[model samples]
Target: MLPQERQKEILKLLQEYRSMKINELSKQLNVTRETIRKDLYEMEDKGLIKKVHGGAILNKANSETNYDHRKYTNYIEKKSIAKKAAELVEDGDTIYIDYGTTALLFAKELMSKSDLTVITNSLPIANELVNYTDFQVVVIGGTIRKNEKSLFGPVANLGMEHLYVDSGFFGMGAISSEAGYTNFHMGESEVSRRMIKHSNKTVVIADFSKFNTVAMNKVASVDDVDVLITDENTNQEALKELESIRTRIVVAEIVEDEKSVE
Candidate 1:
């Protein structure tokens, strides 16, 4: 098969199996192991797959996309994660919600609570919670990112200095045993880092798609996170890594209906 055809086939297989060893891919495609390795490297460069030790894994939803695209990419999984994360909040809690679609969904999940003091850098989350009237929404003042509706930079970092929160919830682009927690945007990751530093407890809200992946910006280590809420679809290998680090994991059961969220 041509190189493009082989890459396409590899993507299809990864999508089907989620991940595959390089030798297995070579045998399956009747290609040399070196050819498989080259294809995997190129695919990883394009953000299509993540190359892991001895293997490559499907990573279609992990690429950085615009807000609307990400908001709907893993809708059900985000809902489940948001619901599970919301369970940790109390009516009078003071919390920090960072920028991202999952974080926005998490803000929505907090509508049931009363007297929440929510500090955030996400315009969507701030707007979503503001209408409720009972919650006090504080937007982290910083340079605004146009399309993504987020704020960051030194100003935002300075804003986090004087404030302390009961808990801080963040969405990550990727997480791994080695990288800990990372995201695509440096500014956003810095804000998350500050929030984590200032909060008493840090909670990471992410779906299974983010597991075992590494992104550009470092947020915090697994040890910094007090709780991690993810969907049940997360793989065992990834879960075991988090377990080995002694990270508290909450597997949010995926409810097919929105009854729980509503």
Candidate 2:
């Protein structure tokens, strides 16, 4: 990888792990300890990471933006993940769509399907799916998280009671072997837990960036998910972690648009 590309991967790792030893980064990125040290030095000079005694930690100043802002960050990758996830849905199936940018894209991917029921707390997802004549969109009501534009709380929890689905599709803040599946928002995590409880199958749709990361609130264990759909760029170690737990990993290939053959 180019120096810049390697540094970007290092930043992503630090963001997920919070901190890392030089040797750890070297192993994960398949580089030498000296190269990791040099990358840390450059990243520190750029104010993206802080070089510690033997490694580096992400600079809080370089953290991600709000929910709406993140929707555009990894557009193509998320779309590809969403598309692959949508394929798992058969017509006439009932499924729960969790609240997140990727979940919203998954909702859009389902627009062409017929006779489906979508359960969601995300206003964007419900609004998008409701337009489809063949879809039955169920909105879980609760206190609104304005920034995320999703609902979660006791009322939403109550809404989940006695309701069940064939499958539950979720988007997580992060996933790792040690941390399992987690979310940054506690309320959303609870909602995800309840959805997983009521569904026959659980599918997590997350981009490669979410792999190997741990978030603030626990949602589910790695083995709790039946299938995980991610883009091709997911880290090898993270994939191995999922494999160890027996969570089915589906890597979505990013297909490029075909050019004119002439």
Which candidate comes out best when scored by TM-score?
1
Clashes counted in candidate 1 amount to 0
Say which candidate scores most in lDDT.
1
- Whole-model Cα lDDT of every candidate shown, in order: 0.86, 0.85
Per-residue C-alpha lDDT of model 2 across residues 225-246, encoded as one tens digit per residue: 9999998888978898788889
Residue 112: error of model 1 in Å?
1.1
Candidate 1, residue 77: Cα displacement in angstroms equals 0.8
TM-scores of all predicted structures: 0.76, 0.75
